[model samples]
Target: MVGPIGNKFAPIGDPGRQAYEDSLQVFEEVIQAACQQVGIEPVRADQIAVAGEITDQVFRHLIEDDVVIADVSGGNPNVMYELGLRHTTGKLTIQIGEFGQLPFDVNTIRTIQFSRSPRGLIDARNQLERALQVGLLEGPDLLAVTRIFREAQEGAADIELSTPDVTVETSDDDAPGLLDTMDDVERRLAAMADNADEIAAAIEIIGAVTESAGSEVQKAAQSGASNSVRLSLVAKYASDIREPVEKLESQSSEFAEHMESINDGVLALLKMIQSSSPEDRPEGWEAFLDQLISMAESSREGMEGLNTFGSAAEGLGSLSRQLRGPGRKINAAVNNMRKAIATIDSWDRAARSIRKPSEV
Candidate 1:
């Protein structure tokens, strides 16, 4: 088995550098424990002759190994990248991470999440033993593995395929009457509203975490650390920033889904309102009509908001381009701008052509 420790040793300044070293120590102990649990000899770096750095030769050797045990803690980019390479080789690979450190995207993939406590380490080792057993036998379903190896290397138990349940409490007075019936559009719009609320709340939480992380990193930098310490801290800050930003982007995508559902609901509501005769209208039909109109307006507004957020995200893409230097930045910027403009144009068309109930 090959265990890559590139990210654990990656240059981040003083405190973070020390933290990374400590993490590596913990990683080594855990790996040995896990191997013992599985009845395998714990392989050390010196024994395996693997370099700490992520050289192409090291990566090639890892890919050629019979099995891979990767530590994905701290969102280690190089480790993740190599793990991905290992997956492409269609070998047995096991994933583990520090508790709560797994990326949202990778959380669905079965992983052993460890804590600092001895009991936690033992539990993680047990889990890893089970994973290795299964992985050794099955080889990770070659055909079903993700193009992204890290995703593919995820064990079955870790994948989250469905959304969590949303609970909304209503007082007797606020509950709808037994006789009330909602058309598809009204029902869909209500659902979209609930989803939007959830997404908004998630965004707020992620933003708060990102802000706090940034502040901590800034403080660390200001304390006059050594080069290794500073680099490590900066790298960690970058990784920390990446997580919440990714969550925010994902929530934004969910908002887009909400917008689409609302649009569908509005169109459906408009059609229902247009088709119904005065005799067929319910007792509070006028109220329903007013609500439908309001909902349509809200949907349009929500789409605008989503578009704006998307634009801001697109702006971040420009930063990535600029960091890469001149010629590359222009192409990336152009491509990004083109996509942004296209999305805006599509939203413009959607907004302008949304049929009013009266028109329908």
Candidate 2:
């Protein structure tokens, strides 16, 4: 049961079939098996029986079909057009895409993303089958409605996850594709590490500038320099630290934003884990936990790094307070840490609940 990977043929006057041929072939094999597991016939829209049926026949299926499994590789214009028509219906639509090619329209929607490797093909099939099982249960459509924007003026999409024990809120343009989401987690972790280190270095530069001006400040105070002259001295010192302070604030803001997204992905993942039963874990339970634990640890480290920054920034109390925007970010980072720690604690308890089969 495999159908519509787009009417992708070389002479067909459509360039939508841009997936690596090898991976496409793998998808065909595994998709059929997945369909068979759930007693559904898979059909690819490779052709239209009637001339105008491209609109009439296809439109009927898009609207009337129980579910539509769209492989949106290459963001094929044809597939996208059909997918858009289906979106208006808000029916059961499962979108699958190649890594790094996720589109903005479905950015916030849950998508199955895979690389073009052998294992990746198998993983995509597994995810598809699970999605089918969930959809057939009369659950919400994968593309149920236009995603809600948490910050309307900012136009950012949000994923808010909460359980009795913990709550995590984060915003995304779309999500990091689950498979790609992990890769994104890794990238952001590295970037956060870099940003934190750079901030520490920038702070050192500020400290040096302050110490260098100490003697001059003392001399002016002793000599009873006039108010204007003393103010000029302060201005010169402020100038010396302005560039580094500004840099610190910019990096701090980015750090806060990135940290939120990281926790967002982590919490999104944890919810998925809690939803699945022990008998049917999402992906391989072991591998999933491995990545989850790694991200959690990295986030803790990031939190500590921010704590260190907060302590260091406190030394610049009066000066930084006068520079309002620069100091605002540190507070956000500290607050984000508190939220993330709650998320991690919840995750830790969940992980410990999963015992190995041998141990069980």
Candidate 3:
């Protein structure tokens, strides 16, 4: 089920209202596409048979719908209230809104961001579809999990504060010197490898927390909550994802550069092979083939890493659509990385074909 359809959510004006109408129309498109992507029957309150009052219909849908899509744009109170009702049931729900339109309270949630422009609408639809597929498969109750964890942490902190003189012991072996710290880079990398399986899990948790905050923001906005209150709610959520997005942007850019360097080297070797006679072929061509094989393997690994970080960055970006933020940079970085990977793979294949027994 989806909500805040028609003019009830729009502002009272001419061009401004028209823009909202157009954006909402596009959002509906996103919702329909999301249903198709996840292979679910699309049901919304507006679509239901008018067997009774509209309120009753909305009430039933809020509690019973398999999935609920809420548009929190313009701080629409009705949609926010309906979304809150859906949450109480703990059923699957997804939130979406325009860039810079969602309330700061709900801004922490990973909303599928859209623009009023033609291009923006198309991008929003595609993103909403992907998000639905993921949400359905993962069954993330990010809001619920975050709330439980937050309450638990608060309770634990209270208990610790009340209990004085609580201490733990550490061994001399646990201490690391400057040399050990300097040499820990490889160990850190190894630990990252070991922790690879946890990336998706961590992303899920972060997304849930963000989404939870978004819902709260929506609710508070509807209640005419102050800016300070909303800002406070999002502070922790923003900090949680912001640093990761920045780090990802840096790493992905560096990775793309590496791939470009490798790409240039491979093209040079390929040109050399194409122009050379068999007798005049580079002496170390055989060893170069081995290195190419290694680079191909690394490229594949880089692609996987890019994909993982890209997904997280995309969610974070959706959370905050500032021009310099991860939401924008993540997409560019991911696209560049993908192009690089494809080029590298093609070059790998070409190099291997040249090294074939028939070619020799």
Candidate 4:
């Protein structure tokens, strides 16, 4: 199955020793049973080619395998790209995903749903076994869901597949045409639009909260509240802001991971495009690379801002711990308030740095 395999994708618990164990269990049990139902031995991308580079092996499997089962949990980019490659071949492909983690691009496609629980796992295995049997005998109905596969099957009969690179060569009479390219571009644009909307909405909400907190602070100061009371109010505001900052930081990290994957994809595309004739290359390819570079730089800047805020918060915490005595408790509280404001401000700056792609 095409999915993440490392510890980083592992579910949390068991002091981290059981990293990826649950995922492995699900895959080994369900996929093996599915293969048995189809009366075939299961062969994964990793197992087929033991000596070559991992990606090359994966590409070979994507093209040569009679049927592919993709586990698309976490929306892992490598898996998605491989799934795309498999779809382009017009081969039998089945997609499975955790209940809620499937990406938007693949959400409309029919996928066998799985979960982490024991009952869910049992159901998933049974469902996959049936799906596999049907797919092996009659092929799957996923063609309509993936425009790429449908276009390839209709417009490009007999796709060429080679080792180390799964390239599609078409004849003059029945070239896959621009529809497939346009569809890919549309999906990329949609994914970006969704991410931008989410980031914009999150930043707007955070900004509104910060503004309200500032107003309250100002009002409290003018009302002659005691320093202790004002400190307490600020502390509460700081605590509230921390949750969103943490969330934004998590989003930023995920964004960085996704962009790294995009960078790899862009590099691969550039190599492939350069290998082809100038006429075959997509228009404005360099411009596309430039846009990616600009976004990468902005992402780097945002990550740096998060690191800075983290350092500052750690320093403030250290300072607060160093302070002793009842008199210094208010001082510690003030420092915490300052640290929270700094963190919120840092997040706002980070948000600004991660501006819309159109802005770049």
Candidate 5:
């Protein structure tokens, strides 16, 4: 536990003394009680028995704790600083605050909010227990800042897969850092779903044109200049599908990102539903679970199609020199798409893991 230790609980006057006492009550009754219920030992930095620099102790606690319960009440600068540092580790972090007092910057992230009343404290305890249970089951909640590092790691994996047996040489060390915001990345991913249809259509156009043109080119190669005019006419169609090639190039990365987005959303929803009290859950949650599982299964078909199309493009490129350039471009787009889809297979397992609190 980390928060509101120095200035916050310091006895400045009668009012401040009462506030400090009340803070102690909340810690004992709400936070520590929840930890005991979850069978976990709760530790606070100020209560540490070991002698060391306070900063080192706090940092060790924040980094090494199996779980960190952070109280953001009164927006204590020290607490906020510690919380920021904790977030960097992407460890199990549970944020709680006096009701309505969560820092504005982090208000949207999942937090256990509680009133100062006795009843509110009880509710907070129950909620925290459930959160810890669900967190242990699902691992840490994926924060956007921490998520960027994972995404970069996945990008490195993409580079390796794109080059087949060869070691891919790319500087992911310089890859753009934490996205502008999750909302922007999510919005771009949403656009990716729409682009998938367009890309599919473009793939068809390119595939159909290549196959028909390849037959002529094959005959021309066999019989010599007799089929030159036919080759010229058929070859022009590749240029006609230039727009499609460009679309695939532009949108394949976005297309793959949608899969990752879905993976994140699906897991988040699963955790939310699993952690929530029965009264708080939406109707038809079971149906939603089924749908999420189905979505994961459905994604595989698209992945298979794109992969097959990529291989087909490679094959067609060999059939005619005219198609070699465009085939390579489309194949590269396939690499981008595969990169996004590659890491999202976790959603399949996540989908299967969905179960009620009783089952857990």
Candidate 6:
């Protein structure tokens, strides 16, 4: 299918006009070559009809055709959705993409990757011919497709399995007894609570800094600085401070939710340990065990949220430093903030580990 490459090409904007035209020209040539390679007479028209009706036409053709070749080079959402519909109909579908342009979700799929060069196009045509011989007439080989998918999944599994496990040692003499471990967990929970408070304080500080910087920019503009100079200063201020402020605002609710989940988990773990006994045990050891399980679950969720926040914070800091230019006090300050966030992430992980209960 062709045309309506992407929304970026929907309007005749200066940035994309030439590139869009070039891509369409290339796509038409590729399709013509593909048709000939499969022993089908190439459509006489060099140009494929480009209009709103193309999508409907393609869908109807897909329903009738024994095989469908989809070009997903531009990552067009509409094309991807239509391709998905083709898959649902159980037709033999061959996916093709430009080199280095595949979407993450379908990167593992058995796709024909092609470069934009003449040699690459020839190679892709040959491959498509072979695929058509095997795929179209045979009505799609389920076993081959299954094997391709299984290998991809197994490669991902292998990466997870290869990750090194972390082990912590305790002294045999002053080894952390159950009680000691429990105490440590409590201390870590308290520290996490303190860290959450610190995050809130840092956000407030960032807001204040932004406000002060804005005021300074206004004064600089009014102090007879050139309009160009004032504009540059304002841009720098936005580039340096806006992201951190925005990110802090965006993540506030998420951070609060994570902290609340962690707090609840810690409290439940403490109660479970405190109420344990040989007889007349806690009313619901099984239920209490479930709470411990939830503790791990919630801790993981909270950590993931924090990790996201950390990444945002790091990007904000990096952008801030870049805006401030080199060898400046503001650049140094942003770098320090980045390092502080990194340290917080490390300490947060350690705290969570300490709070995690031993497996029964």
Q: In lDDT terms, which candidate is top?
A: 5
Local distance difference test, each candidate:
0.50, 0.60, 0.58, 0.55, 0.66, 0.50
Q: What is the C-alpha lDDT profile of model 5 across 165-185, one tens digit per residue?
A: 332244777643223233443
Query: Candidate 6's residue-wise lDDT over 194-289, tens digit each?
Result: 444544554555556657766877888778878677667656665665555444433443443444444433443434433444354434434434
* lDDT, residue 315, candidate 4: 28
Clashes of 6: 0
Please identify which of the two predictions, 1 or 5, would achieve the higher TM-score against the true structure: 5
Worst 10 residues of 6 by lDDT: 157-166
Task: Give the runs in model 1 whose Cα sits over 4 Å from its true position.
Answer: 1-13, 39-54, 143-360
lDDT (tens digit, per residue) of candidate 3 on 222-340: 99989787766666556666665455555555555555544434554555554566698756666555555555556455444455445455555434334236455655555554555
lDDT of 6 at 159: 18
Per-residue accuracy of model 2 over 259-332 as CA lDDT, tens digit each = 66776665566666666676765555566565445555655555544544444343344443433444444544
Better by lDDT, candidate 6 or 2 = 2
Error of 5 at 127 (Å): 0.5
| Cα deviation of 155, candidate 1, in Å | 27
Q: Which consecutive 10 residues in model 4 have the weakest lDDT in total?
A: 322-331
Off by over 4 Å in 5: 7-19, 149-360
lDDT of 1 by residue, 1-360 (tens): 333344444467655566556566655667776677667765434355655664756666676667667777776676666766676776666777777676543433445667878787776666666556656665664422343345636643322212123223458785543233245445654664564454445445545654675576677778876767655654554454454444444544554454544443333333443455657644655555555445444544433333333323323333343222322232232223222223333333333334354643
Candidate 6: segments with Cα more than 4 A from true spot? 2-19, 41-55, 142-360
State which candidate, 2 or 4, has the greater lDDT: 2
TM-score of 5: 0.44
TM-scores, one per candidate: 0.38, 0.38, 0.41, 0.40, 0.44, 0.36
Order of quality (lDDT):
5, 2, 3, 4, 1, 6
